[model samples]
Target: MRAISIPLPGGPEVLTLGEHPDPDPGPGQVLIEVAAAGVNRADVSQRLGHYPSPPGTSPLPGMEVSGTIVALGRGVVGRSIGDRVCALLPSGGYASLVVAEAALLLDVPDSMNLVDAAGLPETLATVWSNVFMLAGLRAGETLLVHGGSSGIGTTAIQLARAHGALVATTAGTDEKLAACERLGAVILINYRTEDFVERLLDATDGRGADVILDAIGGAYLDRNLNALAPRGRLAIIGNQSAARGTVDVRTLMSKWLTIHGSTLRARPSEEKAAIMASVRENVWPFVVAGQVVPVIDQRIPFAEAARAHRRLEASEHIGKLLLIP
Candidate 1:
């Protein structure tokens, strides 16, 4: 099997494509003959030596993949070889073959191809777990997503809108904001030129956002608190910015706000399985009905993984980036 490996933790240049042994499925796992993989910010962090794959997991950089099942390990049931599935992988997705937990596998929708399905697992699981399950987002409420042009943010906006919630998003450019608007974002804030806290509050008539999905952690913490409505939930899924920051204890206590943070890669397999089940039940219908779609910015050959990393690091993309194997 050909795989992308970070021989040394440094930059995109460190990624090397070389021959590696094919991974075999362990108990409760499935081996997938990879067709395509999703590129994520977490992959960037891993390449730069900032994030490390969990102990006992593969050291490769990809987090999600779409492919066909070639074999199932012991204890796996209800799934078989020849099934077309997209799965959330802890690591090793940047290869011609990878092994994933069977429970984390999701059936590809009839309307989507395998390549597009590659982009769905990580972002879909992230948004559904953070925004809907953890924050308890409900209909008629206001949901605010940071980095609206991002794969996760775009997915969040469409899913929240599909659930009948008003969506607000912040981006750095006019073009990015327009993309968000087309995805049903009612309020678009240009973070480079305006204060998102003020714009979000004013858009909701001072009510602020009931649920806020944030990727920029500490850099926006203070402003995020100020922008939250009473009883609001702030779900932090990434720390793209600096991770350390001071919190205003008074505001948190007075407003009764909740700040929750989670990382899907490090979680137990059973938890990811539960989240996938919820996504299939609650979110798959929206995908089938055309209420949600994969927004891809670019597709690169698997051997050119470094170029994909460079594109994502430069922040030039509008949505998910895929690597075709």
Candidate 2:
């Protein structure tokens, strides 16, 4: 099988395309002939050798994949061979073939193709678990998403809007704000120039957002707390800025706010399976019904995985970058 491997920790130049042994299905797993894969920020970090794969996991950098099931492993039922499934993978998605847990597999809607399906699993699973499951985002409330032009942020905006929440988004430019608005964001703030804290208060009439999906951690810390209403929940999914940002305990106590931080890859397999199950039950229909869509920024051939990594590191594109294997 043809696979793209990152041989060393460095620039995008470290990635190489060549033949590797095809991975086989293990217990409760399914072997998929990969068609398309999603490129994520985690992949970029992994390529640069900042984020390493967990022990016993594949060294390649792909988090989600869409493909056809060729075989099922032991104890796998309810799914069969030849199913057109897209799944959230812990690792090893940048190849002609990869294995996924059967429970993590999602049936691609009839309306979606393999490429779009590839873009859905990772972002959708993360948003569904963090925003709805963990944060308990309620209807008739206000929600703010940081990095609104991102794949996760764009999906979060649309989903929160669909569920009757007023959405606000923060990005770096007017063009990115426009993209966020087109995807159902009710308010947009250019974080690079203006203060998002003031905009959030202005949009919500001084009440602040009920919940926030934040990826930028360092400089946005105090401002994010300022933008939250009393009893607001802040779910931190990524630490792109500062992994060791200090927080004011007094602000947290006075506001009665809840700040949560997590990384999906470090979680146990059973927990990830549960997240996938919840996404399938609650979020899959939204995709099928067209209430949510994969916002693709670029689609390049799989062998150009190095270029894809470079594009993401430069932060030049909005929404998801996909590779067709």
Candidate 3:
């Protein structure tokens, strides 16, 4: 198997495509012949030595993949060889072959391209777990998604809209904002020019958003609280800006707000399986109906994995990027 190996923690140039021993399935796991892998910000963080793979997991950077099952482990049931599927992985997705847990697999419909399916698992799991499962975003409520053009952001916009929630988003550029708008975001704010807190409040008649999906951590924490209505829920899934931020406790007390900080990669396997189960039950139908689609920015060759990292780090992509193996 050919996989991206990080010789050292540094820049994107450190990711090297090299031969590796093919990994085999273990108990309750399956081996997949990879068609493509999703590129995410976490991959870049791993390459830079900031986020290490969890104990006993693959040291490789990728976390999601689409492929055909070639082998199944003992105790795995209801799955077979040649089944088209996409899976959430703890690590090791950026390879020609990967070992995935059977419970984490989601069936890939024949109508969808296998390569495009690679981009869905991670983002869908992230958005579904954070926005729907944890935050409990209800119908008729408003959802404010920060970094609205990102993989998580794009998925959140569509999913929220499909669930009957009003969508608002913050992006850095006009083109990105327009893209978010086309994805069903009714309120689009250019963060580079407009103050999102003010815009959100003004658009909602001073009630603010009912739920906020924020990736910009420290830089936006205080403002995110201000942008929420009473009893609002804020889910923090990433800290792309900075790790530390100051927030007023009074805001939480006054508004009875809820804040949740989470990460998909570090979660336990059982928890992930539960999340995937909910995603398959609730989100898969929308996907099958073509109401929710993976917004792909580009697909790069596996050998050029470093270039993919650079693109993600520069925030140049409007949605998910894929690595073709």
Candidate 4:
């Protein structure tokens, strides 16, 4: 199997393409012949030695992929070889082959492009788990998604809108914000030019958002609280900025706000399986009906994985990027 390996923690240039021993399925796992792998900010962090793979997981950096099952391990039931599937992985998605727990795999419909399916698992799991499952974003509520043009952001916009929530988003550029708008974002904040907290407050008549999906981490924590309505929920999935932030405890207590932080990569397999189950039950219908779709910005060749990292780091692309193996 060929994979992009991070031999050292450094820049994108350090991602080396090399042949690795083929991985076989273990108990309750399945071997997948990869079609495409999703490129995410976490991958870049891993390359830079900031996020290491979870213990006993693949050292290679990649968390999601779409492929066809080639073999099934013992104790794996209700799945078979040749099934088209997308899987959430702890690591090792950037390769020609990967071994995944069967419970974490979702069936990819024949109608959807297999390569594009690669982009769905991680983002969908993250958004569905944090925003809906954890935050309990109800219909008619407002959801303010930071980085609205990102993979998580785009998925959040569509899914929230489909679930009957009003969507607001922050992006750095007009073009990106426009993309968010087209995807159902009603309030667009150019984070580079405007204060999102103020804008969100104004747009909601001072009520602010009922739920906020924030990836900016500590840098936006205080403002995120300010942007929320009373009893609002804030789900933080990434710390793209500094990890630490000072919070105003008074505001949190006064408003009865809730803040949650999580990462999908390091989660236990059973937990990921539960999240995937929820997604399949609640979100997959929307996907099959085309109400929710994977928004891909670019597809880079597997050998040129470095280019994908560069594009993600530069923030030059909106939506998901894929590596074709």
Candidate 5:
């Protein structure tokens, strides 16, 4: 099998396609013949040495894949071989073949093509776990999102809206904000020209947002709390700008806010399985119904993985970017 592997951590040039041993399914796992893999920010971070692969996981960069199941391991049931499935892989998505736990597998919607199905697992899992499961984003409440142009942001926007919540998102430009609007985000704030906290407060009629999904952690910490409603919940998934920043505990105390942070790939196997199960039971129907769709900005061949990394790093894309293997 051909897989993109990084010999050392550095620039995108480190991502190279080469022949590697094919992976086989172990107990409770399944082997998929990969059709496409979603190129994610985590892949770029892993390439640059910031996000390391989990212990005992493959060293490959990809975390999600869409493919046909060619083999099934022992203890796997319900799904069968030759099924068209997309799955959240712990690793090994950059290859032609990947092995994933059966519980993480999802049946591709007949309405979706291979390229589109490739884009679902990571974004859906992220949104379901952080926004719905962890934050408990209830209907009629306000949800504020940073990085509105990102894959996670787009997915979060649609899911929150579909669940009957009011949504707001912050982007660097109007173009990106407009994209968020198309996905049901009502309040759009250009983080560069305007203050997100002030804009959010104004849009919510002086009542801060009930839920906040933030990728920018360090510099925005204080402002995020200020933007939250009383007893608000803030779910932090990434620290793209700065890893550490000071928080005003006095303000948090008065507001009675809850600050929760998490990463998907680093989680324990059982927890990841639980997230996948929730998606299968709750969100997968919405995806098949076409209420929320994957917005792909570009699709590059698997051999051009470096170019995919460059585009994501540039922050020029408004939606998900993919790699067709």
Candidate 6:
């Protein structure tokens, strides 16, 4: 099997394709022959030596994969050889073969191609867990998503709107904003030219957003607080701009805002499995109905993994990027 390995992790140049032994399924796990893997900002961070894989997990960068199940490990049930599936992985997805816990697997939708399915697991689980399950977003509420053109952002916009919430999102360019609008975002904030806090408040008649999904961590903390409605929930999943920032205790106390921070890559298997189950039951239907789809910018060959990393780091894409393995 061929896999992309990061020897030292300084830049995309560190990623090199080389022969590696195929992974076998362990107890309660499934062995998949990978067809495609999704490239995420997390991968870039890992390449730059900022985020390391969890202990006892593969050192590879990919976190999600779509493939055919070639074998099932002992104790695995209800899944079999030759089943087409997509799964969330703790690591090691950037290869031709990877092992994933069976409980975290999702059946690939009949309506979607395998390449597109590769883009679902990470974004689906992240958005569903943080935005819906953790924040408890409900119908008739206004939800604001930062980085609306991103993989997580695009998924968040559609899922929030599909569940009956009014969607507002921020993107840097007119093209990205237009893409967000096509995905059911009613309020579009061009962060390069306008203030998202003011735009969100005006769109909601000065009540602010009931739920806010933010990836730009400390840099947006103050504005995010001001953009929230009383009792609103704010979920932070990434710290792309900066890792540390100060929050106003007075504003938080006055509004009674709830804050949540989470990372999916290092969670225990049971929690990830639970998130996958909820996504399958609640979000898969939307994909099957064509209400939500994976918006892919491009697919690069697995051997050219370095280019994929550069594409993600450049922030030139409107959605997910895939690596054909």
Shift in Å, residue 79, candidate 4: 1.2
Error of 1 at 240 (Å): 1.4
Clash list (residue pairs), candidate 6: none
Which candidate do you rate higher for lDDT, 2 or 6?
Answer: 6
lDDT by residue for model 4 over 82-119, one digit each (tens)?
99999999999999999999989899998999999999
TM-score of each: 0.98, 0.97, 0.99, 0.98, 0.98, 0.98
* lDDT of candidate 3 at residue 66, scale 0 to 100: 98
Candidate 4 Cα lDDT to native: 0.94
Runs of candidate 3 with Cα error greater than 4 angstroms are: none
Shift of residue 145 alpha carbon in model 3, Å? 0.4
Quantify all predictions' global Cα lDDT against the true fold: 0.93, 0.88, 0.94, 0.94, 0.91, 0.92
Report the lDDT tens digits of candidate 1 across residue range 152-231: 98899999999999999999999999999999999999999999999988889999999999989998898999999999
Q: TM-score of the candidate numbered 6?
A: 0.98
Worst 10 residues of 1 by lDDT: 237-246
lDDT of 2 by residue, 175-250 (tens): 8899999999988898878888997898788999889999987667777888899999999998888556667888
Which sections of candidate 4 miss by over 4 Å?
Answer: none
In candidate 2, list every pair of residues with a backbone clash.
none
lDDT of each residue in 203-261, candidate 5, tens digit only: 88899899999988888888999999999999999888866877899988999999999
lDDT of 3 by residue, 31-149 (tens): 99999999988888899899999999989889999999999999999999999999999999999999999999999998899999999999999999999999999999999999999
Candidate 6 lDDT score at position 68: 94
Rank by lDDT (best first): 3, 4, 1, 6, 5, 2
Sequence-dependent TM-score of model 1: 0.98
Q: Local error of candidate 3 at 163, Å?
A: 0.2
The positional error of residue 141 in candidate 4, measured at the CA in angstroms, is: 0.2
After TM-score superposition, the amount by which residue 161's alpha carbon in candidate 2 deviates from its true location, in angstroms, is: 1.0
